[model samples]
Structure formats: structure tokens, C-alpha cells
Target: MSDKRADSVAFVRETFIPEQPAPSTATGAVKWLQDNLFPTWANGLLTIVSLYVIYLIVTATTPWLVNGLWNTESLAACREVLDGATGACFSVLTERWNQLLFGFKYPPDQYWRPTLAFVLMFVALAPVLFFDLPRKLLIVTGLFPFVSYWLIWGGTIFTPVVALLGFVAGYFVYARFVKGSFAAGFFGGVAAAIVVWLIGGGFIPEGANDTALLQAVPSRDLGGFMLNMMLGITCVSLSVPLGIALALGRQSNLPLIKGMCVVFIEFIRGVPLITLLFVANVMLAYFFPPGSGVDLFLRVVIMITMFSAAYIAEVIRGGLAALPKGQYEAADSLGLDYPQAMRLIILPQALKISIPGIVNIAVGLFKDTTLVSIISLFDIIGMIRGPILASTDWNGVYWELFMFASVLFFVVCYGISQYSQWLERRLATDHR
Candidate 1:
């Protein structure tokens, strides 16, 4: 009966079947293409249409790119060389590349200074962006602002040295007083820094720049892609911390603090960035002492920082609100104070949630740095419109010039986007 039952069971394997590779049609590139591009008849048709469109675009652009004149001195020369062939006058980019990077007024001899500063910026940012790096590298990050300022602006070393000292003094004061009251410490730190600056101002000799190793370059001379990068980086850095404070303040139990934060965020958000920029360019001067003549770059930084902070505050507030009640309760149960709770627990989670929004704001803020061109600052676009195109050599090379600018902006924006995605993945601790 057992033998008959075994025969009826029909070939139960005595040994386990060996694992085999998936079929070529069910794996690898072929499978992926089939699943993604041609899973359905409709998708296959759409893919074919898309390919045709791409092919057409490539055909249209290939000749222009292939025949582009890079060595010609002028658009006319480029056209003569092309002799009515479909081609691009890309020589403008090669010729005016310096002016497109650093404004025409920046002394060509001193170009190495800004170039060095630009390179050091990456080194300074590495530790801050990638936390797995040695924490000691943060010292470089701390000194970078002053060092880069000295390098790019090229003045008496005393200028940045004094600035650094002022910050050091402010930090000490903040550290000393923070154990007592946060507000007192904050205000005390500011007052100390101001005092340090005032004291340091007297020590810098009036003829310092004349004797300095690197000749001073005034802020007005800063332009092109360099100016945009500086403004975008500096403002984004300043705004993030300020935005966090504003977000926290808005949620404060103190009505005064909350109201002030609310008003600032709402008012700033209500006003257009260009309007604020106009205020920076034209109106802000009236508020400063008549002889003070604060740098336009500084004014623009302040306005942009404030504008970006408002949006970031709203984003962070949303992030904070997204947290479950248990998170806050857990902090309270741990016997933590408000500041301690925020620093240790609440903020990390909230900031992780807020990363995407903050990155969006940052990318937008970087692009908006081009708007400074409208106010007569010669950012890359300003260089293109004002100097490059206005010149006889490149008068008609609009497409090439603008395309170069677009490429520059796209590279920076894409990098920021990629980094943000990596950061999000890194911070995603929840098991899937």
C-alpha cells in the first residue's frame, strides 16, 4: 500500500533541486528594460515616441555643438569661420571666462587669491557636510569665514584677525553667561563682540592695506559666478541657524517672543525677495550712520539671510509639528529642561524631517542670488548681460553665454540635491 501511495505521489525529489540562475528574460538589463520600458503595449509605444523625440533633439543640436568655434576672438570671426554653417560661437565663454567667473574689475594678477579661497572652501566644508570625518577638522570650518574673507577681499590681515578675535570674545562671554540665562548670555555675547570690534578697529593702521601682502579688493569689484556663490553660501549658512531660532521662538510659551517671531516670519514671507533686495540696495543705506557706508554685499547678505530664514522657519515649524506627542513627553519625563530637551531630542528628529524643505529653500536661495544682477551687482547673469554681450567681440552670442551660465547653476543645484538625498538616507534610522 505504501509503495502504491509513493508511486501515486508522483516524483517527490529524493534530493533538493540545485539553485539556478534566473532566465535571461527574467533578470538583468533585459528584464529591467522589459519591465520598465515595455511592460505594456502603451508603455512600449510611449518609449518609442520618447526615443524618437530624443533622437530629433540630438540631431538638431549635434551639428551646432560639433561646429562650435571655441578659439575665435569674436562672434563675427566665429561666423566667418563657420561660413553660414549651423554652429555656435562658444569663443565668448573661453575668452571672457575670467570675467564670467570674477568680474572685469577684479585685478587679473590677484585672481590666484580668490582661486585659493575657492579651493579652501571645499576643505572647510568637508567636515561640516560629512560628519564621519574627523571632528577636529571643525577648527578649519570655524576659521574658514575669516580666512576666506581675508583671501577673497584681500585686505590687512588685521581685518579678519580682529573679526576672529571678536567672535572668540563673544563665544567666551556666551559660554560664561549661558549657564545662568540664555537671553542674557546671547545679548552679552553680542555686546562683547561689538566691544572687541571697536577696540580692534583702533589697532589696525590706516595704511595697512597699502603695506599688506595681498592688495585689497573692494566688495564692488566682486562679481560673476564667484559673487553668486559667496552670497548663496554665506546667506544659507547664516539663515539655517537663525531660522531654527525663529522656529523655536514661534512655538515659545512667552507671548512676546512668539509674537515677535510670528510677525517677523509673516512680514518677511509676505514681502517678495526682490523687494527686500531693493531695500538692501537702496533703502538700507538710510538706516546706517551717514558715514558708515556699510558694504552693499553685507547688506544684501543680511536681507537674503532674513528672507530665507522666514521660509525656513515655516518649514521647520511644520517639521516640529509633525513630531508625535510621545517625543516631547519623553523629553519631559527624562527631567530635561526646554533647551536640553530641544538640543538632545526634539531638534534632531525635527531637523531630519525638515531636511528636504530646507534643501529646497537653500537651492532656491542659491538660484535667487542671480537676482542681485537686477540690482546692478555683476553676478554671472549680470556679466553676461552687461559686459560680455555688450562688447563687440561677443555681441550676438546670447545662447552660448546663457547656456554656460545655465550649466554652472545646474551643476551646483544638482550637487546640493544629491547631497541632500544622501543625507536623508543617512539619517533614516527607522528599520524598513
Candidate 2:
């Protein structure tokens, strides 16, 4: 009995009790380094190299960030202290921040106009980003431009009122009669836009009587970051839909239409955007009749739209191709016509798939708007360049100005990337 009890106790202890911890030297930080950093010969070599690189970066960066001579109060002070040494000049950034945010030409008292426009733009765009917004209210978002123009320009109310009426009438005619197809809606919208332009441009003799109002807001006075934003947004918004149509046309069964689309896309994609801008700036006049001079701003916008559209078409084509043939077959089996299949079934899925790619392209286009500097447009980057080169007080401020601009671009691009990621996650869930 005693022997049996002793045996049972031994078995119970062996089964229930935990083993003692391993030796300290073979675990914790040392074990982690062994397993992760030096798991193999190659890994050990890589680990050592990476650590050395990190050490070099840290040593190089610490002094510049914490103790560098870049923190002077003025340009002269900075030059005096640094004396041919290389470091960032952050003081210039502090002094010229206002000019960077709002162009140098913008009057200090009238800075409110751009600020207000910027705020309104964000408000109008909010609904687009947040899916919880009522879709029906999107019409108001589309009208935001007219509202913003009136607010910024402080024009006679009659002009904006007339434009708004024409727009509403156009929307109704297009939606009810034109049936929302691209061709009908486009032509109808164009007709409405023409009417608005006539009213704004004072084609009517009575409308022309508002000379004081027209004189109050001159075309030359309208060049700045606000102009850049307007041009970029309008061009992109118009181009994206056109691009969708072009992409679909390229993929269509009709040989003539497909061939034309292919030629256009290939031709535009082959040329550099700078060449297109130069053509708009120089060659567009030759295309028009002798006395009909197009606005430089309008020409630039046209060029940007065409360039962006071609690229967008390619991206959308990729999305369309990625879709399974089964999807097309399924749509046909459901008795839906080609247009119905595309609009209701195919495009939504395809566009969702291409959202991230499209946003990336958009960010690139936004950054490229800086190229307007080449054509004498006073965009933010262009404005910075002038002051950096011309100003006695701000000369040699390239590092500060470039750093600030980089941060601005980074923030905008990063936000766009994050939003795209969120959209991707949401769409993934919907697909599942």
C-alpha cells in the first residue's frame, strides 16, 4: 500500500506541476537577438549592417536637429552665424509663411476671401468623403463653385442668381428629358453653362451695364493659389467622367469607336505633360481664328484636363480588365442591356477597385500643378521661388521654403492615401 501511494503521488506531481524556467542567459533580450537578428549567417550579417546604418543616421541627424546653427532669427543673422556651413534656415519660413499660404499679391485685408473660399471648399467636399451624407444633397455640393465665386468676388447678386437659375433649369431638362446619359447631359449642361457665361460676361446689353461690378473684379487680379485650386479641381472633375467614357469606348466592340479611343489615348499618353502645356500656351492660338484669343488660364486648364483624362482612362481600363468575364456574362444573362450592365453592375465595382490608383494619380497631378510656375502662374511654389530669388531679406531661403512646401505636400498626399486605404477597407467589407 505504501509503495502504491508513493507511486501515485509521483505521477500526480509529474503531470500537474510546471517545469522550472530555463537559464536566464538563453532567453529575454539575448534570446530575441539570437532568434530574430542572428538566426542564420546571412541574417547576422544583415543585422549588423542594419544596426551600423541606423547608428550612422542617428549620429548624423542628432547634431543638426538639436544643436545646429539653423535656428537664427533673421537671414543676415543666419548667414553670420552659419558662415558657409550647411544647415536649414527655419527663420525665413516663419516670416514668409503668410505669403506661402496666401500668395504675395493677395492684399492683407482681403486674405479673408481666400480663407473663406478654402473653408467652403472643405465644407462642400466633406459630403463626398463621408458616405453618411445624403446623396441627394450632392447637387448643392456641385453648386458650390457658383456660390464660392459670388462670395469671393463679391459680385452683383443678379449674375449669380441668373447662373443658379440656368443651372437648375439645365439639371431638370437633362435629368427629365435627356435621361442622364453622358451625351445628352453633357450637351444640356454645356447649353446651361453658355447661358451663365453670357450673363457673367455681359453679352446682353443690359448685363453689360454692370461695368462697375466687372471692373471691380479684373481677370489679372484672380491669379493665386485660389486660381490653382479652381483650375485643378474643375479640370479633374470634368476629365474623370470623360476618361471613364473614353476607357469604355476603347474596350467596345465597335471597331471605329475603339480605334479612335485607342489613338487618342495612345497619342496623349506618349507625349509629356509639359509639351501639352506648351502647346496650350503657344499653339492653341493658331488653331483659333485670328481675333479669338482664349484666356491663358482656360488653355492651361484644357491641357491639364486632356492629360489627366488619358492617364485616368488607362487606369480604368486596367480595372475593367481585372474583372472576371463571368461578371459580364452574369449581367447579360440577367437581361440587362450593355449600358445598363455597365452603369448598374460593372462601373461601380470597377471604379471602386480603381479608387486607390485614381487617388494616387490625382495626388501626382496636384503636385504637378507646381509646373504652372513654368508658365508664369503664381501658384504657391511659384510664389515661393520669386521671393527666394528676389527678396533681399529672404534671399537664400530655399531650404526653409522647400521644407515648408514639402510638409504641405506630404500632409495633403498622406491624407489622400489614408482616405484611399479607408475606402479600400470599406469596399473589401462590402465585397465580402
- Highest lDDT, which number? 1
CA RMSD for every model? 2.6, 4.7
lDDT of each: 0.92, 0.74
- TM-score (C-alpha, index-matched) for candidate 1: 0.93
Native-referenced Cα lDDT, model 2: 0.74
Clashing pairs in 2: none
Which digits, one per residue and each the tens of the lDDT, describe model 1 over residues 1-432? 998998888665779889999999999999999999999999999999999999999999999999998898988899899988999988888899999999989999989988999999999999999999999999999999999999999879999999899999998998888665454466588799989987898899989999988889999999989999999999999999889878888897778878999999999999999999999999998987678668899999999999999999999999999899999999999998776788789999999999999999999999999999989899999999998888887887888988999999999999999999999899993425
The C-alpha local distance difference test score for the whole of candidate 1 amounts to 0.92
Worst 10 residues of 2 by lDDT: 212-221
* Clash pairs detected, candidate 1: none
Candidate 1 lDDT score at position 385: 91
